[model samples]
Target: MNNINKNQLFWASCLALLVTSLSFGIRAGILGKLGTDFQLTTAELGTITATAFWGFPLAVVIGGFIVDVIGMKKLLVMAFLFHLLGIVLTIFAQGYWTLFISTLLIGIANGTVEAACNPLVATIYSDNKTTKLNHFHLWFPGGIFLGTLIVILFNSLGLSWQIQVAVMIIPTLVYGYLFSKLEFPVTERVASGVSTSTMYKSVTSPLFIFMFICMFGTAITELFTGQWIDVLLKNVTDNAILILTLTTGVMVIGRGLAKPVVHRFSPQGVLLISAILSALGLYLLSTLTGNSIFFAAFIFGLGVCYFWPTMLGFVAENIPKSGALGLNLMGGAGMFAVSVYTIFMGGFYDKLILQKLPEGANEVDYLNATPGSEMADALNLAKNAAGPEILQATLIVPIILTIGFLGLVIYMRSKKTNLIISK
Candidate 1:
């Protein structure tokens, strides 16, 4: 048996989760200033921000294979070093390539953390996996709440955004200390002395496949909103910082309140409702003008809050035997899927909005012109030309959510039937 107390395990999980959340906050919260600092086109910045995700899928895939071999303790220590170096390099990135490299390294570290910690948490609290996992994972957004506030504060202080990015080191160091001092539990699935053959078989099971698909759509939904909100809000206002701050604020609140909300409704039910609201919210956001867009963002934030962490919780409860390898495989798969989606969206945004701008029209004009409205004609004369492609691309997310919701419904019904029959 591990010598560590339950409180140590709980706090270690919290600190690890907080680091992940901080990474996201830094990614989204500093969007506008980073764009300005690098003099990057909106399309270019999208690619840069999405670069970290490029490494995520690979790391998780590899992490799953090695986590059991290498042990969680080794991985957690490496996560700190990787994230620290990545953050330091990001601070000095003078151009896009440097930023891209930094993001890729950070992604690997972040992915490794996911691989180690998810399994650790599940094993640590295997008895109440759902409830404990939900509580443990809350810091993912808790960091975002703190991160968003930091962005606002840094702006008020007139500090370099570069410095703000570097500030990630603080939490990185703090978490490193916590993880270093704590004793970690062995993988529960492995601890029972199960054969490696059995563990692999569990991962390949049919239920695992369903959870994978569910997580794939879930990842796309969560990341699409997080990565794109800053860019999307640009359509709503010239005060890009303020708009991003508002969106991040809503995310913080929604995630903070997720546990209570989840207690009332099951994770699957929460996802089902979220998908509908997110789809409706995205449509409203993409089409609305002025103040309505702000409200739309709030609605979208509400819809996205539970999708990511709750999905992790679901896997913990439903697939206790697969352990962290299962969590890493699924979580990493979702992020990998999101990266691919983001790349596609980036290409469409560039071709449809950025590269093909008209001679004199501003992007703001293109955003404000309603579909089939005469303003599009007047606006088309400006600099940028608006196309239906971007609008169509935005709709893909909602379509995905609908498909995912159907899958969840089937899974829920099947699970219930299995339980009753087994009983």
Candidate 2:
């Protein structure tokens, strides 16, 4: 028998997750810089950023299938190795291809963290999976909060973007060191004696299938928009990362109080309310400008704060038979959906910008737009038209989620008492 320190592992998992989210927040913080430095168009940059999202699913899904066999400890070690290589490569990246490959490696590391930790957190807190998962996932936004501040701090000091990228190495090393010494427990499914064949079949259930598809919507609405949100909110404020900071700050607090929230609303009820708030917040953000967007952002943050973990918890609690594979698959599917939408919508963003420009004009012209210059006028026009339309298009997701979750709430109410997760 192993002497497992549950609290130590939980905090280590949070630190590991912090490294993953730091990459995201730092990447988001530097996206515009990468575009400007590389002379990339919005579409090209989107593809570069989406590299991680795509690679994320690949690792998480594969890791899902083998996490049990290879054990969570080894999987997290793999996360550390990949995280180190990926962060180092990113710090030295010379151009687009290098950036793409490095970001992809980081994405795989991020996926591995989830593959191991989601189940780890759930397994340890077997009695309170949803709240504990929320508590663990709070660091996603929490790390993002720290990441944005890092960007702001580095930018304020006139430090190079490479310096900003290097900051990730610190957390990577910390988590790697912690996990290297910790003892891992068997997964809940393995401990409870769920069979592999049974786990496979659970993934195919109608409820599981439905949740899997819904994962697409939630991921897109959160990750896709969050990736480029600086641009989306630029028309409102020059330093839109502050807006993202504000949103994530609220997420940190809201998720800290999740135990009470989860108990009061039930996971399904919380999801329904969150979907409505997300739709409203996205709509307001699509329309509002100046100071008003702050309130909208708070609503948006509160709305999506619980989405990722709660969805996973719903599956784990309601479909206990599905096991580690199921949880990882759900997380994998969400990232995969974000990967697809980021590229597709990115292309659409470029197309819309193209229509707003003169026949020979390109994004570089817009990027280099100077006050009162022809390209400046064209850039202004595109910002007025294309950007809002992109946000408006994304708004449909949370709106649809509102409808979906409303149905979910009703459906949960109709279920047999034993299947219910409500208070």
Candidate 3:
């Protein structure tokens, strides 16, 4: 295979990353505004966010099929259209359902973007699939960092959050323009002339199952961390923007540096370490108070930084022929799993902490509480009212990490065994 023109691929992927990161950044930046505007509870907000995911699985599936037929340019154009429409809808959105519908449309667009670009990156560098794919994915968090900075500037200038959401249209239009002119690579499955039935058959293998399992744990680890960090910090302290900046900042650095570390350790090894650290970070943050909690969040961000993209890269390296279909299935499955996981977290947090708080427990006092004797009373009060739900939420990261680590070991070993048997 010809070596990919790294410069062109890099720019294209950056544009894709910018759009992806901007979508998430805008959602997170305007979360507070949505809460105030719609009077949404954490649970309600989870529902609204999760609503966007409802379209994701279907879109990825459809996009996979369509991209193989019509090409990435058409699908990307459709994605941009959906994104533009979603932004417009969000600006005029009045209630929970309106927000839900708007997000659903937007999600369809997001899913298509992932379905098209993931395989595009892999095909562009068939020989250096993992390395190039990791580089491609570095932009996810990189974009988040850029978007966070933009949001901060916009907010500082006294712009309305609605205007902030609308401004995302600029990136969408620009990327759409770039994509419109680019000739996309053919779907790997299509080039191989692999029948749909045979493709489905391929995924029934042990490797596919193992990758899918890892994908689940990784998705839960990633989405839960990214989507909830802002809310989690808000619950702890009033400095939402600062805390978010710290969290995303850590993520950006982690992903930016991941290329080398991932090259050294391999994606599976990075994933294993990430799972452990994420669990440790979540447990530490969930139980601690004051600046320590903030510190723990940064740690968690570091742990989670490599997860989603690494998993995508792993699949690209191992299952290259599955093409956009494989990308869609994995992305769809992961997002759908995260949607369910986030809702569970929302309920778990509500039952254990939000609902059970003492009638007059000041959020500020709770945030400022020292870790020693003083925090005991507050922690006890929270525990008593919240039951075991806080513990449940705390276990989320560790449990997922343990599962992913074990799955990775099993997957790698299985691959080795299969190779030996084939020999």
Candidate 4:
């Protein structure tokens, strides 16, 4: 540990992760603007958003395989360069393809940060990996809180979305400077003398494979819905982005108190309760409206608050042999699932809207119908029903999560003391 500045490296990572999360929050805020400005349909916008998730898994999975050989510093430098390129490309985006490419680059940068930092935090605080991991991950939501507030402020000030995006460059540059002078530690796998081949093989274990699949449910439940919240809940409430700000606000606090919660419930216990609350929250959002929406978002924030970090912690503590590969693959799997789910969720929204329209009636037909006429009434149904209907479809993800976490908690209990404690 000589010459290594743990505090500097750690906060640099928080700031880097901050940049990644800020991108998510800002993109969520501007999704509607991008769609309207580019004359895009919802499906086209979804494909552009999905491009970001697609690039994420590609970069993080590849980084996982190579980080040991190339070092964290090189991967972080890659993230720095990608962040700048993505921002520049997005600010100048002329159409669909340009937006897609720019968002993809940003996703790659986001994934690279996770690839380098998750294991970095785990390596530095070896005695308390899970608790510290949660502390580090608190910044993900903390950044979103800041980003969403920035977006709300920008919108109020009448700033362009481009300027809102460019704000990320400040933190990106700050983290970039901090990292340039800091020394990095070896990954947990390397420090513990685990062989590369063994690390590769460990992720194939029955437990790891189970978590990988479960990750699909947990991640899509949180991310796909989050990225689409502006579009999905817009019909139900005039200020839907406020729900996002509210949910992430709850998440910031929830993650900050992770230690006591983990102590009281154990990691498996935490997953079980999180799954239940998340399911309830989604159900309420699908069913409720008006001021009640904030209540649902708060429930969701509490439910998902501990999910990402705890999932990684469970693997790190119970399956230590899997090491860095396990952690990276776990995070990568979630993003990959969301990549595909976003397209499907978008299609679901488009399909619902189409279904609400009379056969052979396009959106133009609806627009052309005379107000107060029976024909206009037919399309008004689509406008009023589409958002809630798509949210109803999302119920399936969290429903599955509830069952899966239940089984995990029960299994850990039956095993009775070996892996249940999480540390």
| Residue-wise C-alpha lDDT for candidate 1, range 1-423, written one tens digit per residue | 558677876787677667767777767877756765666665677677677787777777788888888888888898889889888988988888998898988888888788887787777777766666656666765676676677778878998778778778887898888888877777877787867777677789887887787777767766766666655555456544454455556666666566677777777777788888777766766677677767876776677667777777777676666767778888888988888777777666655653455556465555455756765554433212332235445667667777777687777879899999999
lDDT comparing candidate 2 with the true structure: 0.89
TM-score of each: 0.86, 0.96, 0.85, 0.94
**Looking at candidate 3, what is the lDDT of residue 1?**
28
User: Residue by residue across 1-423, what tens digits does model 3's lDDT show?
Assistant: 243354665576568667767767667767766865676666788777776666777788788767788876677788888888987898889899999888888888888777777777766666776666666776776666666677778888998877877777887888888777666667667766878777776667676777776677777766656655556655455555555567667877776676688778877888788888878776765666667777877877787777777777777677665667777788788888878877776667555553456676554454345556565456546644352244345566557667767777777878889999999
Model 3: colliding residue pairs: none
Q: Which model is ahead, 3 or 4, in terms of TM-score?
A: 4
Specify the poorest-scoring 10-residue window by lDDT in model 3. Answer: 383-392
Q: Positional deviation of 359 in candidate 2, in angstroms?
A: 4.3
User: Which has the better lDDT: candidate 2, or candidate 3?
Assistant: 2
Best by lDDT: 2
| Residues 84-167, model 2: lDDT tens digits | 999999989888999999999999999999999999998999999999999999999998899899999999999988999898
Kindly list the per-residue Cα lDDT of model 4 for residues 127-230, writing each as its tens digit: 87778889999898888778888889999999999999999999999988888888998888888899977887889988899999988888888888788888
CA-only RMSD, every prediction: 4.9, 2.2, 5.4, 2.8
Which ten residues in a row are the worst by lDDT in model 1?
380-389
- Predicted structure 1: lDDT: 0.72
Error of 2 at 326 (Å): 0.6
